[model samples]
Target: MSTVTTPKATTRKPPTRFEIRADIPAPGTPEGAYFHYTPAEAAEWLPFSVYKLLKMANARQIPYVDNGKRITFSGMNIRAISEQFTVEPFTKPARAAA
Candidate 1:
């Protein structure tokens, strides 16, 4: 009679490296998906002027704050507005019902 034993094999995971990138300005935080930006920074990033920026904020609910003399918006808010304007052809009403 004889007894034999075998050692189990071990598996190794491949080496991995991850890189993070950011273009957000100062005084803001990165939430789960979007970055926040102060209103001054928002004005710079946007095409509209300071006054127009205020109007945009009020009209579009662009998420902003108005101090006694200044106003600021969050980058996160801008991202949300962008999503609202984005259109998907497939999502639109079907021209001819299937």
Candidate 2:
């Protein structure tokens, strides 16, 4: 089985505590980053195998929410996870024949 390498641990600052009406969003700022997505939903872009995602979730490799029946990932986290695994194309010129 392939192993997943999670991002390096970092000191995450505690989330700022505040009281705001969730029904109303701040101006110019969208409040749609908190949506959760199923592994199948993320597969559209992540293109990762659903089985792998579930295995990772089961092994606590990736962020997930298993509500005793279904497993889902927050949209923000899913996107971030996908970005972290993206491999940029090689841009440097090939080496000359030695």
Best by lDDT: 2
Assess the local accuracy of residue 1 in candidate 1 as a C-alpha lDDT between 0 and 100: 81
- lDDT (Cα, tens digit) per residue for candidate 1, span 2-98: 9887988988742111212245453334552344344445556555555666677767556664544344455666656556657767766669867
Q: After superposition, how far is residue 47 of candidate 1 from its true place, in Å?
A: 4.2
Residue pairs in steric clash, candidate 2? none
Instruction: Give lDDT per model, in order.
Output: 0.52, 0.60
TM-scores, all candidates, are 0.40, 0.50
Model 2, range 29-89, lDDT digits (tens) per residue? Answer: 3453565556665554465777787778788877766665567666665766677788999
